[model samples]
Target: MLTDPSPTRIDEATIRALPKAEVHVHLEGTFALADILFLAKENGEYLPGPAATLFDITTHDAFAAPAVSTGGGAGAGAAGLSGFLRFLDWQCGLVRTPAQAARVAYAFAARQSASGVRYSDVIVNPTHWNAWRGREIALMRALSAGFDEAEQDGLCAVGIAYSLLRSQSAASAVDAVATLASARPGHVVAISVDGDEKVTGRTGEKFHEAFRLARATGFRRTVHAGESSGPDGVWDALDLLFAERIDHGVRAVEDPALLARLAADGISLGVCPRSNLTLGIYRSWDEHPLPRLLAAGVEVTLNTDDPAPLGSCLEADWAVTAEQFGFDEATMIGFAARSIEASFADDDRKAALRSELAAVVDERSRTGALSS
Candidate 1:
């Protein structure tokens, strides 16, 4: 039944209840169409599409909002990833004040809480928030203030990781890092470079100094690579930026050497299968290398890269990947445990989260609710 094209038989509710951490999600792209409509109307931005059509649009079909009609790109469907990206740019442009940024953070945490994600390290690239470009520190504070409120309400504990757009100039990268490093924002935990590596070409050298400065300042490092580029991009992130984790490093399987190094070094990959499938990274789930990577001992933790527009959720990721790969309950738990261990959260928080995961598993095991 493993690797069968048929949908997984695992209990999705069980997966939804598991204590988990989401590490690779992007705040800019996390908004639902409903959220998009709400945020747009609130800020008085032009409606992206007709209200009736947009409200009826599901996340799975959101990518098809005509690019030419929206902002003009490749076309529709997968071409609409660009369309969606433009959608994000438009939505993100609506945040003109710190209060708006805080609201975005609080809403993001609440959404994650509904999915049972106890903690999250969300990627927030200032470049996406064109309105807040010059005032990054204030932006960070506003987001943190929002997250702090959510946490107080017993929602997921959220940490911000500034994702440097890959296409930004090296000087721009350094300046961003310098500003963040100087402020040392408590809520912002890591520094990451995310964008189209295929389009931006190699950026390891471009971000080396910035990452070095970040590392020296005790900020964690993660990089978006191996998704758009090949194994070489992963290597550049590892060697150049000293990234502790590589987002979408699925392509590492292409190089035996790189794959071996990743495992031996215990580098984690925050793999987002739905994102990959939506973007046509693999033609089908059967073609995905997630199973192979797990077998190869990669510390792979599942995530929904762009949850809203991609129509993704963490529980579905766990259930589907478990059934598709024939993973046992222990394997699913291992992935969840690794997500906590791999987090940029402090040692005490990590321990608490790990305890929470263990407690949930034990309770489920006793109640006979677990699938396997």
Candidate 2:
């Protein structure tokens, strides 16, 4: 009766209840069309299309005529790259205020809670907001408040990692890091370089100085590398940026030496299955390098790079990774363990999380929820 004999079938309900951590989520990236509409309406920004039609407009051509038609992009049935870019542009519309930022952060944590995420490290890019109003302090305050609220609500413990836009000058990054290093949100977990990886490949040297300074100050470091280009980008991030973690490190599989290096260095990778599929990073889920990375003992954790826009959820990621990439329950448990190991949490907390995770797995095992 089975189409093919496989160790893992990844039934929907099983994946739904899987306890895991989401390490690479973007706070702005969680914006839903409805949230977008609400934020835009509140901020008095005009939307490119109706709330009902934004997803449809997501597929419009990059160079497509703007405002020339009511029915935009591809329809709601499917989305294209143009549609995603449009969504990105629309994202810039909602995140203009501290209050809005807090609301989005709370909402994001709530959604992750609903999707069964036990812990999350949400990436917040303050660059665009600074460009809008120059109130980075207010933004940080709002973020901290949201994080506290999420924790109080029993959703999960949330932490903030600043994503310094690589497009900004190295000096700008220094200022941002200094703000994070000196602020009330002094426990800012990590300093990450994000935004066009192509540009990162070109200017990583300029940012390395700032990254080094941040590392010296006890700020964790990560970079968006090896996703958009060759192993050189990975090399730049590791050798130059001295990244503590690498996001979207699928390309590391191509070079065995790099894979060995990553494993030896114990640098974690924030892998997003659905994000990669939606962005055409892989032709299909099975073709994804997640399994190979894990097999090679590379430290990797699953995440939804962006939840709403990519139509991905934490449960969905678990399900797809298990179903597509051939992970059994043991493999899934190992994946969760790997996340704990790779997490920025302190030693005591990491031990606690791992202990709790083992308890969950044992309970699931006794209940026959997890199979071989």
Candidate 3:
């Protein structure tokens, strides 16, 4: 039933219409330029560049730094992590209050709808908010309100994953995780790790300790690894952090044994093609390691790591992967199922999403509307 996307196969529109979940998005990464400009103006902050300059990564390793926890006010650098941070630097000015944070959350959901994203769990870092409010709970409260508002607008459930950067001291990360733990149940889904891959690089001790504490607290975990680094980074994340998933595990493709281990363990890879391409993991979309990973039976799902900065949407990401890599409908559908299975959403929610995905695929087949 899976029709692979090929030059002579399915057209672009079909891929766009397919139901899917975006699993690897970052709240700070996807901040739109318009939103950045407005937030900066409202908060009297100086922005780093014009709206058009936000996505400028001249080379792949340019986005390798961990995020710094500057107070809610703008910092010496733009957003403060990658180009996405520059955009954040602009918006941090306005997000001084809960209302501004809610606005950003609602806007994210609304934009995601246009991209045909049925569901998404965004990672929000509370350290910055805490630095400003002297209370870490404000970030959780603002994002909870945002998700509530998005749900009212008919958007599918939007979950939050609290994250902290590798640059934070071990004590800081522990506090961030503690704040995240207290805010659970009625709000955020789980806690995660993001920031410099080197922090978890084969030899980084601080990150190893931070992640251990997070997992010990019963928080679900995922970490950024093997993006700017290599397979050992991926292994470290699995062994040390107890990651249920790896954000950008494409580098695993280079090690056949490791790939087999990933498939055997049933771990998930949150693959983001545009992010990889922009970050220089692949020369182009068609050259991506996704196809290789798929062939090896690794559980892989498509996502737009940072939609705005990278100029990709969820649908666009799916479309490009299918068309460029020759993914048939069956493969695409399988990826969707894998995404639902790998989601932090509980069993009932996963069942509902998987069933809906199956029905959509079946109905498309029954109607004979699929392009071949």
Which candidate gets the maximum lDDT versus the true structure?
Answer: 1
TM per candidate: 0.91, 0.87, 0.85
Q: Quick one: ranking by lDDT, best first?
A: 1, 2, 3
- Give lDDT tens digits, candidate 2, residues 68-94: 211111112244433444556556556
| Candidate 3 lDDT score at position 221 | 81
TM-score of model number 2: 0.87
Spell out the clash pairs found in candidate 2: 58-83, 59-83, 60-73
Superior by lDDT: candidate 1 or candidate 3: 1
lDDT by residue for model 3 (1-372), tens:
123447555544666566666778877766677887787777777644444654553222333244442211111122334434433443454577778888888888887767656677777765434334555577678767887898788875677777766566877777666766665634577666666564334533556666676677776787777776679878877887778888888889889988998999999998887777655555676667777888898998887776776666777677666777776777677777777777787777778787777788888989986544
Task: After superposing candidate 3 on the true structure, give the runs of residues whose Cα lies further than 4 Å from its correct spot.
Answer: 1-5, 8-12, 46-87, 127-133, 198-200, 203-205
TM-score of 1: 0.91
Consecutive 10-residue window with the lowest summed lDDT within model 3: 69-78
The number of the candidate with the highest TM-score is 1
Better of 2 and 3 by lDDT: 2
Q: lDDT of all predictions, in order shown?
A: 0.79, 0.71, 0.68
- Cα RMSD to native, each candidate? 3.7, 4.6, 5.2
Window of ten residues with lowest summed lDDT in model 1: 67-76
